[model samples]
Target chain A: MAALDRSLLVVIVDVNPAMWTAEAAGEHAPFVPIIRHLCMFINAFRALDGGNRLAIVACHAGKPTMLIRADEELDRSLHTVLDTALVLVLLATPDDPAQYNSVMNCIFAAQRAAIMIDCFAIRTSSTFMQQAAHMTGGVYVEPTAQQELGLAQLLITLALPDRACRALLRQPKAHDVDFRAACFLTNQLLDRAYVCSVCLSIFHHGDIIECPACRSRFPPPPRLARKRAKRAVAPAHGGPVIGGAHAAAAGAGSSAPRPAL
Target chain B: MADGRDARDARVSPLITFLVGQRRGRLGRLYANPWTCEAVVRALPPVARHYALRLVALGDTGDGATFAPATLEGWSLAHDAHQAALQWLLDLSIIERAEQPGALRLNAAFREQCGSLLCGLRPPAPKPPNKHTPSADELDAHAAAQWDALLYCVIHPSEWSDSTGYDMPAALLEPAGLIAARRVRARADGDDDDGDGGDDVDDDDGAETIEVWAMSKRGATFVLQDLSAQAWHILQVYIGDDERKLAFLLELAHMDFGHGYELRDEHRPLIAELHHLGIVHVRDAAKSKSFYPTRLAAAIVSSGDISPGGSARGRAIVESNLRVYVYTSSRAWTAILALFLRLRTLLPNAVVASITRERIQRAMREHGLSAEAIIAFLTRNAHEQVRRRPAEERDKALTVFEQIRLWERELERFTAKEAYYLSDFDTLALFDAELAHALASGTHLWHRREPGNARLCKLVLHEREDVIAEARARIKEFKRSAGLA
Candidate 1:
């Protein structure tokens, strides 16, 4: 037999608590069909190449568990031959901002390892998933309510294409990312957040006597809070030109008592 | 080596066409079955499989079969192997041309079946009966004993009488071309020369005759093939042109390795035959209600990863220095290596060996082993350690194969050919003209030139009398026209 140019595919199935039990969401998330779709998609993927190796991983409450990995002999030896490795994430829950840094770190590590991360979300595309897909140059597919009925078809059609075939095919383009950083204090998505002078701890509001994170002492907030609050509010509703002007003036005025980190 | 491989391909390619390309009407339903689909995929080339799989994933959509060929990039329609790959998919009916000119669509049945199979809709194999069933290891041992006994009987029948374990029917061996029988003039002369021929006689013709038995040419090459290939050949021999039986054999690959399926009235005869062939484990062909598919059965449609019977395990580490370390207790592994390698040490469950030139040459001469076959076997069974090595270091391992190839070539000292030599040319122009004519017809072999002369003095052409005679007539006409007659 000729030595085939084999590739490795890692499929991560996300079964987070929010996926099945829909307390806030209206409908029961057709678990059987989704599983059916995933299985069909994997079947189609495996069919595409005889030599292509695959591993399945289930991520639920805590750490991810590898459900199955074929041919353990190729475990780490795969890294060198792992040039064609692709990591696919089937995400159901929306991104939790608390785990944003960890997710991004994971994405960065995947990037450094040169593995592509493709995401197929249930209904809405999560922000972290979108970024991961975008950074790795993989398709991020979010089926519409109508398309979700034929999720198996969509998953197979869009997500099964390898790196070379994906280049030639029409894929679901990544949408415009929010690019906003979440505040560490409230875990809320924010366009602009107040940063502590000492610890650089982010928050939605600026009314604080001391840095909560670093315990750095500061003068009472009445004078500093009033000015920082106005500067932050004026730019969000204003035009880009006005926002730039406001930001520049605030930076110029902030030379009074800025703490060195 | 190259000739041997091409010949084997000539034998196997048609088997693919035969297995997969059945009655078209029956094929749609066959495609709807996952087992059939699995078997079909195994028959296709790697590239065509990729293309078929991609198109299958594209789905029928009901909007119209997708315009897929247009979406595919970097394809050249004019004389490309990629074109052949596309044609193969079309031939297999995995995909077909749509209403649009270049559009291709997936077979609807194939697509739906792939979905449900992956979706876990297929029922699991039934559990074992209350009676004891053979374990996987026991099955392997049984298969090995059966296969080795059959092979030993065919290769050397002097040691074993009819009472031993494997009484592989001679009827089965003849059709496979493993053993051949011929009636020679039964001379009442020297008995010493009958060392290789078995004296199995048929007195049905009322003539005093002894049937001489020997391994055929196909058998020489057949002996060197791995277990999967050998099993497939055996099955092909069993399932000749019977389409129903061919389809039935494909089911074994899809069946669970150790599970048993109850045999129906129609399937009983086939299962009994498969039992003798070591494909299925049927303890009592008449009394047993069900038959178990052995690992050899898996090889009927197995891809490379499938560890078929006793053969497909990758326990050997073939290094750059031509050293082989086999970590297998199976005699099959050591015996195959012994065909080409010079053994140095034999520890328990392991063997140390080196590939020496003389052994390879001897195997080439005696066992009809080819360099390509040896190299292919080594790489196919190579440990993951070889796969993990750096690319530069990998080249070193490759060089070892190249050395083996060179050694094979080194044995070819000269080639003999039949040709007609034409000489004594009067002019450079006439010599060149004759050379051009011969070259155009592809009968010209070579021309000789003296050290001091620029003009060709002699030309050698192929030994085709008709072509040579035609050339003679043309030369006569030319000579008369040029006033040299």
Candidate 2:
């Protein structure tokens, strides 16, 4: 294959006002160091290839929006242009669940275009962003609060390679993807939830007759005799349960579920 | 110099090779020129370019004068990237090892000039503006026409009607071994082996076909490369034995396309030289005395995607049935197509053709074209219809592509190498000892003991002289010990 002459990089920053404020209350201002490192990383990428481009997207109040474009002035209200992007870097924190759909739409679109989405989670771990990175074959980095290995160091080491060079470099492997999807109804994380077979939308309640997404009617789920003893048999695990209905229900109700998928 | 040969053997990009092979004083002088420094930095590989930029960035900040080995560790570079970047820097003389054991200092001239260039601190040298400067479209047209004509002249000499009014110096190309001229008798003399019947036509009824200059293997490889790569290869050929000429040409790479530079007395010959190579176009031969750098010139130091008129993307439309429709009216492009395709018809805007085994084999055997080269050419010029599809499914002629590769592999199945054989040892002890010696030297190919003859053994292809002498001495010693001399 001919060498790639140009590559488009899209950086997604999670700008949750609350998280930044909480982080600022600590010794160091949280966003300041990250923003500085991000600028350096962008410069490094631009210096690497003159034709390489960058676009900055900010996830504000659960709404995924564009903050800056390589050519255009910074605009907070604009939607991201992900079509031409070869790599998407997301600086995420534990964000609002409400923006999950829009953020996921962007992630899926980037995935379809074969755009790698690298997620650098700050203090809080954003499960959905992790899923975005994992599903799209990107790196998911969670830098420790310690100053020894800073965000700039991680960015330079892990996220410098474009698509072509990524093939040669050894990427950081994601331990386990959090596949626990959010419910469409309440936006709550679901474990042992009912899946709308037609639309595949997860729901916390199994008693509903119709899928809220597809509006398809279904025959009632087979009712097994309630067995409390069977639910106690399986131990509580941190990972998402990957089994049929029986294991899911027992695993979900038994413990506080970890966010994933 | 040995460095030039090393560059040639490694096939380094022409610009970088030129820079690496220059004398230290000349190189420093070249870097002192801001335009040349900018062009050299632009032509560097991405990782090396990044390292230069990073160092310049550091110099911009009032940091330490030299970077310690630990500074690179702070960048957190991967092992391979760090090694590659350092090797390139050292090879290009961009950085030198410091007297201090673990430190490196950037080349002072390169650092200063490149920093100024990158930081936009140094304005470009003043050049007088001319009134008859060509537009971007005009420059593109001139580049395309001139480049196409040059290629057509090299590959299809009979079709060289001098339509572009640009004459390529065949003597100049001879040293590069890109094309070779051979005298052929007129077709009327009954030489039926002119299979294609394309370039063998007589100009006049009584005229002979005469000399036919056909493309050599290097020329085939040249034509198959992307236009930017082709320009670089040609430039390397033209810059042979002239580092000063290359330094001037490298400066041209930093010039903006469609911009006119006044033709100074010193630049006139160089400009004329560039005009011959299709890198620059003179605005007017009579009144106007300015030259415009074409897209080809600007593209040399920039990315490879900047083809003439942006037609590099998907120019040839290949159908699922192995038929091809190339959307180009240039005679040079058509001539290239004729190399491997059996042309059925030619339209004003396109040429219709199909892949035939006989035509492909003829190209492989006669023209020295490889299957990979053909595939690359097709892929580089694939039509928009094919390009718009997902990359995995884009090659509609994939089956034919595989078949062409298989055919090429068939031709490569047989190969011959030079080797020496050792045989007729005096005894089993001598044979075993010689075999051990050959095996120890790692020069042994194969060995065998003659059936029903325990005294004789053979070893094939031992290239080392010392091993052969030792084996001979051992055999003689064994013969003398047995009193059989």
Compute DockQ for each candidate against the true complex: 0.24, 0.06
How many residue pairs clash in each candidate at the backbone level? 0, 5
lDDT of 2 by residue, A1-261 (tens): 113455677786767777666767883454765676677667556544445567778877657687667655212322243223445455545755766666677777766767787878776677777777776777877777763135554675577666555554556768767766666788887655655544555566655666666677755443442232123323223332223333544444422221111
The runs of at least 3 residues in candidate 2 whose Cα sits more than 4 Å from the true structure, single-residue gaps closed, are A1-261, B1-14, B17-29, B60-67, B99-103, B122-131, B157-167, B181-213, B241-244, B285-289, B390-396, B413-485
Which ranges of candidate 1 are over 4 A from the true structure? A1-125, A135-138, A161-169, A194-201, A205-261, B1-32, B39-88, B98-105, B108-112, B115-120, B129-131, B147-210, B305-368, B378-407, B418-485
DockQ (model 1, Cα): 0.24
- Model 1 alpha-carbon miss at residue B14, Å: 11
Worst 10 residues of 1 chain B by lDDT: B1-10
Candidate 1, residues B1-485, lDDT tens digits: the string is: 22222212232333356555466666665676676776676567544555565555545335535666645434322234355556666667777677777777777888777655555554346566546678778788777666665555455432334442443446567777776765544657713142222333454666676666555546646655666677666776677656557667777765777777777677776776777667788878777877788877766665434454555367778788888898866554555566578888998989999988888776676656678888877776777777777889878878879988888887776577999887766566667777898989999999976544534488899999987898788768877888888
* Best prediction by DockQ: 1
Q: Which of the CAPRI classes, incorrect, acceptable, medium or high, describes model 1?
A: acceptable
